[model samples]
Every structure is written in structure tokens, then in C-alpha cells.
Target: MVSLAPYVLKRPWLTKMLTPAANWYASASGYRQLGLRYDDLLEEENEAVQIALKRLSAKEAYERVYRIRRSVQCSYTHKLLPKDQWTKPEEDVPYLRSILAQVEAELAEKDALDSMTVIKKH
Candidate 1:
């Protein structure tokens, strides 16, 4: 659970310095051109991701699958989405990351509670 985001965010200078480079990296990664959100690239084999996907609204789930399938089709055909169809930076939100964070937090809380010892004085 050691995330560098908090550390980077805490330093405004660092955030300012890295924002453009991060955006450039994201754009260069080409998922956007394939009409895929950053979250769509996340590994689906993990329990946390599975729980997160399950928590998504039906529409969101359907859209996620559509994006993945479309991206796969694009890969098969060796084509990128049309320029107009590329995912806009504004539209590329961390939908799954927030839910995954919540699920992980709940799991951690459960683990903590499960390991707790109770003592009673009569």
C-alpha cells in the first residue's frame, strides 16, 4: 500500500514538474488511440480488480467490456480508432482505481478486525 502518488502530490513542485511528462507518457502509450481508458489496461486476474468490476454499474461494466473488445479488434486489424474516436484526456478518469481502493481498504479493515483479540474482566 505504499503509493508514491501521495508523496508526489505533497510536493507541489514535483507535481508541477511531472504533470506534463505524465500526460505525454499517457498519450504516447497509445491506449487512448485504441479508445481505451487507462483503467481498461489494468490486469483483470486479481481478486481486487474482480471485486471492483463487480461493483461497477451495469452500464459501466458493459462500456468497459465494449472498450476492451473494441481495442482487441483494433489490434487484430492493425488499426487505431479514428482521430475523433480517441479517448479524450478529460474523459480518461480512474473509475476502477477508486473502487479498487475502497475494496482494498475494506479488505484491510476485515483483516484487522479478524485478527483482533478480545479480553473480558469478570
Candidate 2:
């Protein structure tokens, strides 16, 4: 994946300029109003997501399910969560991203090991 996050983070000026825009975009995306974190928007069909879900603590997993169910209920009712109940910017952390990254790294490492050739040293 070619992410510009690293490049943006490397330049203090760019980070400063984009931070507010990014925050505004995230808020405008409406998931927060549904009380769902950014990580909850990730698709669940992939193996990495499955692994990441499994890696979540019981509380975190339950909370994730609750958010999804609540969001669905809101969708059905055509309503947004009350202001106080909305997911705060600070609360919209990337809970699954770290675990997903770890899973990807492990899969990559496994692939590397599997593709290794044995060299016999006499």
C-alpha cells in the first residue's frame, strides 16, 4: 500500500497544515456521529480484519459489536446519535490498525520463511 502518512509525518509543516483538514474530513465522514470509531469502518471480509478482530480484547470486541449494532439501528431510524453520545475525536482511535499491521507483518515473515532456500554447509 502506498500511504502518504509517512511522508506527511516526516514534514512538520505538512503535518501542521493537513491535521485540521484531516480532522474535518473525519468528522464530516459521519461515522463519529454514529458513535463508531475509525477502525470500525474497515471491512470485515478480509483475513487481516478477522485476525485483528480476534486480537481485540473481549471488552473492545463487545464494544465494537455494540457500536455496529447501534449504528445499524440508527440507520434504520434515520437518526444520528445525540451529541453527547457521538464518538469524540479522541475516541476515534485506530484500534484495529495496529493489530492488522502486526498480522500483515507476520504473514509477510511467514512468506519470506516459506520461500527460503536451504543451503547445506559442509
Candidate 3:
């Protein structure tokens, strides 16, 4: 999906104005309350995401798995984590996004190369 995120993020005033609404929306989305960072909720079925996940540092991968498992357990129990245990706003940084972007770029570049036509000049 195309997003205005980059555009809005580039403008200081827009970002400042939107930050609270974004935070509220995130909190209201309930994943953080379940102790899952936003990245933890990304769809793993995606090829780019799968590659990005594999590229994560061991510690980050472990932590991501732990968070997912903990969230799953919470889901079974029908309970949210205690407030202190909930993912904090700062802690909800997009750790996977950068890697995912890099993987996507690589895939696009590979596709471009694959589609290239080699023309012999006489």
C-alpha cells in the first residue's frame, strides 16, 4: 500500500501535529498492551519480511520470538499485560522496517536486472 508517511514525516509541523494521534491510534490498536511491538505484528508470510527477519541479529530475533509467544499466551488468556510490561512508545521503534526496506530494494534491483535486455551493437 502506498503511504503518505514519508511525506508527512518530512514536515516538522505535520509530524508534530500527527504524533499524538498516531500514538493514540497505536495504543488503541491493542498490540502494545499485549506487549507486542508494532514490528512484531508484521505479516511474516511476506517474502521481504521473511528475508528481513532472517537478517535480524540473533538477540533481536530471539526477542521478537519471545514477544510473539508472550502475546500469543496473552491472547489465550484474554488479558493484557500489566501497564509496566506493555510496550512503551519509545520501545516500539521500527527495528524491522529498515532491514525490510533494504531487502525490498535488493529484490527490486534483482528483478530489474533479470528483466534487462542485452542488445549486441554491430
Q: Over the stretch 1-122, how does candidate 3's per-residue lDDT look in tens digits?
A: 99999999899999999999999999999999988999998899999999999999999999999999999999999988999999999899999999999999999999999999999999
Error of 2 at 72 (Å): 0.6
For model 3, give the 10-residue run with minimal summed lDDT. 33-42
Question: Which stretches of candidate 3 lie above 4 Å from their native place?
Answer: none
lDDT to native, each model? 0.95, 0.94, 0.95
Error of 2 at 82 (Å): 0.9
Clashes of each: 0, 0, 0
Estimated TM-score for each candidate: 0.88, 0.91, 0.94
- 37-56 in candidate 1: lDDT tens per residue? 99999999988889999999
Tell me the lDDT of candidate 2. 0.94
Q: Which candidate, 1 or 2, has the higher lDDT?
A: 1
TM-score of 1: 0.88
Q: Which run of 10 residues does model 1 get worst, by summed lDDT? A: 1-10
Q: Tens digit of lDDT per residue, candidate 2, span 1-116?
A: 69999999999999999999999999899999999999998989998889889999999999999999999999999999999999999888888999999998998899999999
> How big is the RMSD of model 2?
1.7
Runs in model 2 lying further than 4 Å from the true structure: 117-122
